[model samples]
Target: MSPSTSVLDMLSITPPGWGGVLITGAFATLFISFGAYLFGMTLGLFGALGKLSGIRPLQYALNLYTTIVRAVPELILIVSLYYAGTDGLNRILALADFGPIEVNGLVAAIAVLGFVQGAYMTEVLRGAILAIPVGQVEAAKAFGMRPGLRFRRIVLPALIPNALPGFANLWMSVIKDSALIAVVGYQELALAARVAASNTKQYMVFFLAAAALYLVITIVSNMLFSALEGYFRRGQRPVA
Candidate 1:
C-alpha cells in the first residue's frame, strides 16, 4: 500500500482485521478509567472521612494507605498487583472452598489503577471536606441533625462544588494511568498501538494515531469538566 493509503487504511475504525483494534483499545482505555475513577472515589470518600474521624487508629490507617500508595511508583504497583494480587485473591477463595477465580485483565486494570488513584482521591476529598465551614456542620449538629443527615444535606452538596476541580484532575490522571495497565497485558491504547506498529511496521502512523486518540479524550474531558464546574459554581461565592 502507498504511504498515504496505508495511513488512511490503518486509521479506519471499520472492518478489516487491524483497523478496529486500536479503536477498541481506545474504548478499553476509557472503560478502565471510568471503573477506576468510580472505585477510587468510593475509597476516597471513606478515606477522607476516616482521616477526619478523630479516631487515631483510623487516621493512622488511612494515612498509611495513602502514604504507601503515593510513595510507590505506579509501574511497580501495576506489576505487583497483576501477579501477586491475583494469586492472593485466588488463595483466599480457595481457603473459603470457593472456585478459583481467574482475574480478568480489564477488571484487574481497574482495580490496580483504582487502588493507586484512591490515595490521591483521599487527599483531594479530605481537603475539600476540611474546606467546608465548620460552622455549617456545627449548626446542623445543633439543630439535632444526625451525622449522616448532616453530611447528606449540608456537607455533600457543598463539597461537590469544591471537590469538582480535584475530581477533574483525578479523572485526567486516570485516563493517562490507563496506559500503565497496558504493561500488565490489558490491551489499552498503548498496547494497541504497539501491536499495530509491530505488525504493519507503520510505527509513526500508529503511534501518532494513538497520541491523537489520547489528545481527543483529554480535550473531550476538559470540555465536560468545564461544564460540570460551571454547573456547580453558579450559586457559590467566588473563590478568592
Candidate 2:
C-alpha cells in the first residue's frame, strides 16, 4: 500500500479500527480534566481560607496538606490514591451493609487528579489572597460587611485578577497529568493510543498522532488563558 493509503487505513473508523475510539478517548480526557478542575477548585477555596484563618491549628493543618501533596510525585499519588480510594470505598460500603461498589475508570481519574491538583491550587489561591492589600480587607471590615459579602464583593473579585494566571497554568498541568491516569487502565487518549499501537504494531504512528492531539489541546489552552489574562489586565498599567 502507498504510505498515504496506509496512514488512512490506520485511521479508519470501522469496527476493529481505532480512529473513533481514540477520538472518544480524547474527549474523555478533557471531561476527566474538567471534573478534576471543578473538584480541585472547591478544595482549594476552602483550603486557602483555612490557611488564612486566625486559628493556628487549622492553618497548620491546611499548610501541611499542601506541603504533603506538593512534595509527592503526581504519578505516585495517582496510583496510591486509586488503590487506596477503592479500598476505602469498599470498606465504607461493607460497614453500611451494602455490597462492595466498583470504582469506575472515570471516577478514579477524577478523584485522584482532583486531590493532586487541589494541593497545588491551595497555594495558588492562598498567595493570591495574600496579594490583596491589608487595607482592602480592613476597609471591608470597617464597613461592617458580613464575611460572605466581603468575600464576594471585595476579596473574590480582587483575587481573581491576580489568581487567574497561576490558575490557568495549574489547569494546563492538570490536563497533562490526566495522561498519567492511563496507568490505572483509564481509556483516555494516551491509553487508547497505546492500545491501538499494541494491536497494530504501529507504535510511532499511533504515538505521534496522540502527541499531535495533545499539542493541539495545549496550544488552544494557551490562547484561551492569554485572552483571559489580557481581559483581566485591561485598564491597569504594568508596574515598573
Candidate 3:
C-alpha cells in the first residue's frame, strides 16, 4: 500500500483511530511503570534507612544489594528476573500443592523494573538523607525525641527536597526502561508500536508516534516536578 493509504487505513475512525490504540498502550506503559516506581520507592526508603543505620551488618547487606543491582545492565536484569520470578513462583505453588501461577507480562515488568530501580534509588535517598544537617538530628535527640519520631518529623522533611529531583529523574528512567520489557512480550507502548509498524509496514511513522508520546509524558512529568521543586524552595527561603 502507498504511504498515504497505509497511514489513512491505520488511522481511520471507522476502525476507531489508531490514536486510541496508541493512547491505550501509552496508558498501560505509564501504569506499569508508575506501579514499579511506587514499589521501588518503598524499597528505596527502607534500603536508604538500612544503609544509614549504625549497624554494620545491615549497612553491608544494603551495600551489596545496591552494588549488585547497579553493576548489571538493566536489560539483563529484566530478562533474568523474568525467568527467575516465574520459576520461583511456580516452584512455590507446586510446593504448596497449588496449580501453576501464571506470571503476567505486566507483573513481570513491574517486578523487574521495581527491583532494579530500587537499587539505584537507595543511593539517591541515602545521599539526600546524609545531606541533611547533623545539627538538626542532634537537636531532635537533645529534645528527647525518639529515633522513629525524629526520622519522621525532622529527617524526612529535610531530605525530601533534595531527594525529589532524583526521584523524578528515576521515575522518567523507569518509563524509558519499561520499553525493554517488550522483549518479554509485554503489550506496553513500545511493544504495541513495534507490532503496529510490522503489521502496517509503516515502521518509521508508528515508531515516531510512540517516541512523541513518550516525550510528551516525560516533558509533562518534568514540568510538574519543577513546579513542586519551586514550591518547596519557596518555603525554604529566609524570612525578611
Residue 226, model 1: lDDT of: 90
Where model 1 places Cα greater than 4 Å from the true spot, the runs are none
- List model 3 lDDT by residue over 136-186, tens digit each: 999999999998999999999899888988988998999999999988888
The per-residue C-alpha lDDT of model 1 at residue 207 equals 90
lDDT of residue 222 for candidate 1: 97
TM-score of 2: 0.96
In candidate 1, the residue pairs with backbone N, CA or C atoms under 3 Å apart (3 or more residues apart, or in different chains) clash, namely none
Candidate 1 lDDT tens digits, 1-240: 787776788778786536699889999999999999999999999999999999999899999999999999989988998888899999999999999888888888889899998999999999999989999999999999999999999999989988999999999989998898878877999999999889888888889989999999999999999999899899777786
Q: On a 0 to 100 scale, what is the lDDT of residue 95 in model 1?
A: 97
Candidate RMSDs in Å, in order, are 1.4, 1.3, 2.5
Clashing pairs in 3: none
Give the Å error, residue 124, model 3. Answer: 0.5
